[model samples]
Target: MTIKLMQGNEAIGMGAIAAGCRFYAGYPITPSTEVAEILSRELPKLGGKFIQMEDEIASMAAIIGARVGGLKSMTATSGPGFSLMQENLGYAAMAEIPCVIVNVQRLGPSTGQPTAASQGDVMQARWGTHGDHPMIALTPVTVRQSFDLTVKAFNLSEKFRTPVILLTDEIIGHMREPVKLPAFETIHPYEQVVADTPESYKAFRNEPGDVPPMAPFGRGYRYHITGLFHDEVGFPTQRLDEIDPWLERVNHKFDRHLDEIIMVESDFQEGAKTAIVTYGATARSARHALKIARQRGLKVSMLTLLTIWPFPETQVESLGDQVDRIIVPEMNLGQLALEVERMVGRRKVKRVNRANGEMVTPQMILDAIEG
Candidate 1:
């Protein structure tokens, strides 16, 4: 393992290259621009390709096209750029294309703050893309986890045949820390195999609760790709028979593989009455609060979410059952708290929110707990 001090954005780039991501297409946006800048310089040296597209929408489209052309592909953007990419993001979901998207979030409604850290995009990452599509979004609390989760995002995207989002904020994006990474060549990416011949091909195979193998565009396999509901051969279809099974299979795969897609780190204490749940950089503050609370003779636990969507319902539900109350501190205005309330009920959830381009402080979270 080679150890180096690296920023979160740089680690994401290095992680992508290690995961066999050979093609990258993205527009430059603050906080996330470093990810693209690093790939531009590093990818060409590895015989991979990198191009700055016209804009976020084009960048999103280009990565999908590149992925269809048989390369592991990805893109990175900030809040505004991520919003622009939503249409294509939805397309990736409906078409079942495999690609990774990194959103280094900043304060936002529309370009609120370019350099400030905020996890306001948490809800957006899950539901920004239109329609009821399955999503896998992972949040990393440290620069090292940023590197680790970036690779995991690619692996999940390929395994599930969907777009996976590496959702980090500007704080984690710009923060630097020592990261020891495996040799890039030594990291084996997940691989998929297609049908033996064109004669035996079906673009969307009816695999029960599994993703169908995707054949490269020029690999002697020919099929249509569309956002519209499609059959096994990929032809546009409005037929209930074709649409229903695809819907069931795509949505249920994550539930079946929850252990793989959902990752969380928790510090639970027996007889604790409260649990502080957090993700992204706010988890740092939540930890501090936990320490103070413990020293002050309060029994408290903490749950740091590394995977946000699919929302870790089962675990949160368990926390709700075991604890007296759940406190959620987010850089957003309680976006994740809304989901927690749904799972655990509003009565069991308390929200500590900050969206003013500032990190939630330990005092703020501690106050919520003390109350």
Candidate 2:
């Protein structure tokens, strides 16, 4: 391993290549354009392909098309662009296409701040697409984790046959740090295995294992692909019996293997009565406050969420039982805090939110801890 000074966006580009991503489709947007820039330069050198699409909508479409052709694909964008991709993002979920989406968040409700950092898209990442489909989102607190989680995002996407979102922020995306990346050769991404012959292959089979292996477009296993409710053979069907099975299988796949899907880092002191729950760039500030609180003889624990979606309910609920109160500091107007409040209780949760594109300072978290 070699330690090199790398920015978080650069790390994500490298991670995509390492994760066997051979195709990238994206439009240029601030805070996330570097991800496309680096991929454009590097993908071709490795015999991969990268394209600058007309817009976020086309970018999302291009990547989905590429993935259907059996290439591991990805796209990156900020809030405005992410908003444009939601329609196709939902399609990927319904069709069970494996792809990664890197959202390097900036302030937004309509391009609020292009250069500033914010975690304001937390809720949007979960519910941006108008549908009831399962979603997986991962956040990174450091430059290194950005690379690692980008790789994880691709792995999870392929393994689960779902679109995985790397929900980063402008802070982590632009921040430079010494990152020791593993050798590319040492990395092996997950590849779906098709056990059935082409004559009997069912693209959306609901079998013992709900995840059906995907066969690429030209693999002799031709099956229908659609955004509507699809039967096991991939044909669109309006029948309730067909639609219900697809819904149950698609959603239950995550439920059956949540232990492997949920990722978190818990640091709890023996007698800690207060815990800080955080993710993304704000986790840095939460960690700093935890350290100082301990140094000042305060009992404080911390839970850093690496996995954002399917929310780590069991772990957070257990933490609530141990701690008197949980402090959630995010760069949004209490989006994640609402989920925490639901898992624990509104009365047991304290929220420190910022929507003005500023980092939540460690002192602000420390004050919440002391108060």
Candidate 3:
């Protein structure tokens, strides 16, 4: 294994290739276009497929189609493109289709700044789709993490039989850093849950794991899949009993597996009076602030979150019980801070947010730490 300098966007494309992703369909959008460009060049060399879709909606639909064809598939886009893909994303969710979506978030609220960074899509990644469906979002702070979390996103999607969102901002996507390419043995690829034989297979048949084994259409297991509520046999069912449990299982798979799914790195929290909670690129800034504050004899700990969704309630609750103050600095305007406030009770949480498409500096965090 050799370490080489790579952009975060290129790292995601390479990581997907290492994780056995064979298909990529996406339209170019600023800050995320590198992912599409790199994949288009690399996937063909590895005997894979890449298509420049007509639009984001078609791009999303095409990935879902590729997944059903038994290929590991993904799509990449920015804010406006992601918004266009939401309806189809909900389609993948309701149908329990496993796929990955890489959203390199740029300045938003209707395409404010295409080349600048923003974390405003944090809430959108959770609730972008029209309906109530579970989501898994992984935030990568470094180029290496951009590679690692892309693989994790695929694993989580296949294991849970749901769509997974890999959320990164423009700074992380564009910034270059050293990434060590893992050996083939180090790459843990997921086995697609394909059906065995031609007959005697059910796409929605529940096993002990609650997720049924999937079969592609050409593999001779012909089953219906639609956005409508489906029975165990994969056919539409109008009954509430069928729909309720389907939705419940969609959510339960993540909740029940939080121990493996939720990830956080905490430093010196045993007797700290203040805790700095952050994720994505801001987590890097927080680390610097924490170091400077400790030099000044301040008792401050830090929590760097790698997993953004499923909220990591238990971890945050435990950290909250011991700390008197929690500072959350993000690139968004109080998106994740709202969640921290809700989890840690009221004013115990303080928000340090900047949504002006610029990185929140270490000084901003130090100000919050001193305040």
How many clashes does the backbone of model 1 have? Answer: 0
Candidate 3 segments whose C-alpha is farther than 4 A from its true place: 194-198, 206-209
Q: Which sequence of candidate numbers ranks them by TM-score, best first?
A: 2, 1, 3
Q: Give each model a TM-score.
A: 0.98, 0.99, 0.97
The residue pairs in collision within model 3 are: none
Best by TM-score: 2
Lowest lDDT sum, 10 consecutive residues, model 1, at: 187-196
Cα deviation in Å at residue 217, candidate 1? 0.7
Candidate 1 ranges with C-alpha deviation above 4 Å: none
Q: Give the per-residue Cα lDDT of candidate 3 at 265.
A: 85
lDDT of 1: 0.92
lDDT per residue (tens digit) for residues 1-371 in model 2? 78899999999999999999999999999999999999999999989999999999999999999999989999999999999999999999999999999999999889788999999988899999988989999999999899889999999999999999999999999999998999888888888998989999999987644899899999799899999887888888999988887888888789988898899999999998999999999999999998999999999999999998979999999999999999999999899999999999999999998889899999999999999
Worst 10 residues of 3 by lDDT: 205-214
RMSD of 1: 1.1
Task: Please give the distance, in angstroms, between residue 143's alpha carbon in candidate 3 and its true position after superposition.
Answer: 0.8
